[model samples]
Target: MKQINTLLESNYQSHPAFNFGPNSWAVSTERLAAFNEVYAAAQQLSPTLDADSRASIRQDLEHALNDIFTAFEAQSTDVYEARFLFELKNACVRLMGEELAWYAGQPRSRFVNLTNKRTRQDTVRLQRDRHFFGRLPEAAAAELRNLAESALGPCRANAAVGRLRREDLSVNSGRTVHALRNVLNREFKSLGVLDAVSAYTGRKTRVTGLALELSVPQATWWKNAIAGLERPPRTLYAHVDETIACPKSIVYLSDVTEQNGPTSCYPGAYEAMQLNPLQEIIGRIVGTVGSQADSPLKEYYAKQYHQSVNSENFRRHFMRLPKCLRFNSHIGWDVLPGSELENELAASEIKMTGPAGTFIAFDGARLLHRGGLMQEGERVALQVIFSDSTFTERAVNKLKRML
Candidate 1:
């Protein structure tokens, strides 16, 4: 908080006409006044903005925008910081969008269940921290600064808010959350983590990461620090085929303990899903010792058939590449440079295991993962949301309501 005050104070000093509009150029006075209003508004909108980063962005925008205004007074409408701030703001908006979806996806009445919402919401939130947080591209800065217009909604005020305060949206079903996803995805692509998740999961998508990603940081301080994100992460949400559109999904990370279980994958099984047949299977290793189906058939199967009849369903598994892929963990935060970054990807897909805090980035389409049932203690995981569609109010209603 002190930092933002200090930066704003310093920025004011840079603008000679900030306080004493007593008689400087019209542009200088106008820009300084406008900046001050925004600076003050941010303080009111988010008290936590007093941190060092808020200060940096505030000062950067103040100076950058003012400088652009000065040299191009006639074109004062063109603002530089507008682009950068918008990108950052858009990230926040995405966070809010997923949160809103979490609540809306539930039945209007069931949506009232805070615990249920939180679980699903927490799952998506985890994914945002694992993948999208802290990773920003330089392009957004240019786009917001030059491409954006002054009418752009204030990151803090978010004109959609009108005069309604943050408290106004606190309830289970309120206008506050309903509109958040629209503003977020429409503004920042990356903030929509749920949208990304939906693109990955073909079933009824329940993108956990997108849940409250934008607003959680504001409500909880520890989150922003954990995500290692000062600004918003980029939008990597993608899609597969039409039959299998990634819906919403829960994202999380965990370690291997016999009890905690592990992220399960069917090694090299994607082909079966494509084939969708009745014969093959991937994960299940034919039950040899037990039932009539196996026992009575085992004799006939062994005597009459050299090979066992495997269902295509069993064949549906994630590919395990020779080196890059390993069981349990597909990618590691330490060794992994990025997707296909292990260059020797021609090999089959495998899970790369790691310790706590190890981020596993993967191609969701190719990899099939299941949250294992723990045997010992509770499992710890960092989950994310993946979605393909924009989180509309209608979709949000379907989420919590369906299952």
Candidate 2:
């Protein structure tokens, strides 16, 4: 175990994609030798140990294996690593059997309670609903509305969707908007929204302010046409931004209504998607498929699935997705709508509609959500993505300084 740890420590690099990093070719070469040595040693030592000692050792090994499994779960793996890890995991499963299953079945720890009263209350509601809505302070809201109007007013006149780059802002207005963004960031942090996001993700949080998004009535023409033809358009379906936890916020710069294509989400869907056993199994399958190269079905699988859909074996595993997850298929990740699944969760969907001051914060990765299906009036909003990655944090900080 010490040698194995040393090997992994020397080879591994912290990365969002590959657990062992892109340059560590040694992992593929050395993995089999390490695994075989460990397996042989465990077999030889088992008969000499007492039942209690054996149980303790088994538990420790399971923990170690689960740690490796979880790390691999969060990232992509090459074919060699995937095949070896899969085989090793199966070998451990055979040896540990029901005990391993029982251990892995334990629930994760609950979130720590926040200290501030308002923050605590908001956190509680966010945990329950997987989303929270509030109004920005009137002064701040007014400033934000003014900024959006100045930045996006011309965009509304165009038939196509449009965006105004930060570089395009007048010097004085850019400084004003930048100051306001900083203020809003601090306010969100103080309100405990950032803290709740961190808790949900189990990592430090960073906010990236996106370009103002302007959606006009013309943007929904194709969607309306599809509906008129009795087909469900992609915009009407709910999909996740990621399969993992990623919280985000939206500030309405213009009044948003049901007809204006307000963002919609299903409360409690965040936890449901994460905890579903079927979803977990499918996630593993997708990971395995993604690792392989030159497979006949690779292209088809890649085309059919996105971050939300859990499996690469789409035709087989898709129908087996939990009822809560069926709505994702309708979002066109699977290229077709699952009407039955959509109907099952339709009653619980909440459309975020409010005046220009409305602020909506949600776990976008796990929640079934969709936006920008405007029907009548033009819609303008500012979106902020909250992530737990150091890369995004650094990039945002650099952008801030430049602005």
* Candidate topping TM-score: 2
Candidate-wise lDDT, in order: 0.29, 0.51
Residue-by-residue lDDT tens digits, candidate 1, 271-301: 3223211001111212221113423333332
Candidate 2 TM-score to native: 0.53
In candidate 2, stretches whose alpha carbon ends up further than 4 angstroms from where it belongs are 1-113, 157-180, 202-206, 221-229, 233-235, 243-245, 270-338, 389-403
Name the 10 consecutive residues with the lowest summed lDDT in model 1: 314-323
Per-residue alpha-carbon lDDT of candidate 2 for residues 251-351, written as tens digits (9 for 90 to 100): 78778998887988866544443432222323333333333465444554463223323232332332322232222323422322333334434555788
lDDT of 2: 0.51
At residue 49, candidate 1 shows an lDDT of: 41
On lDDT, the leading prediction is: 2
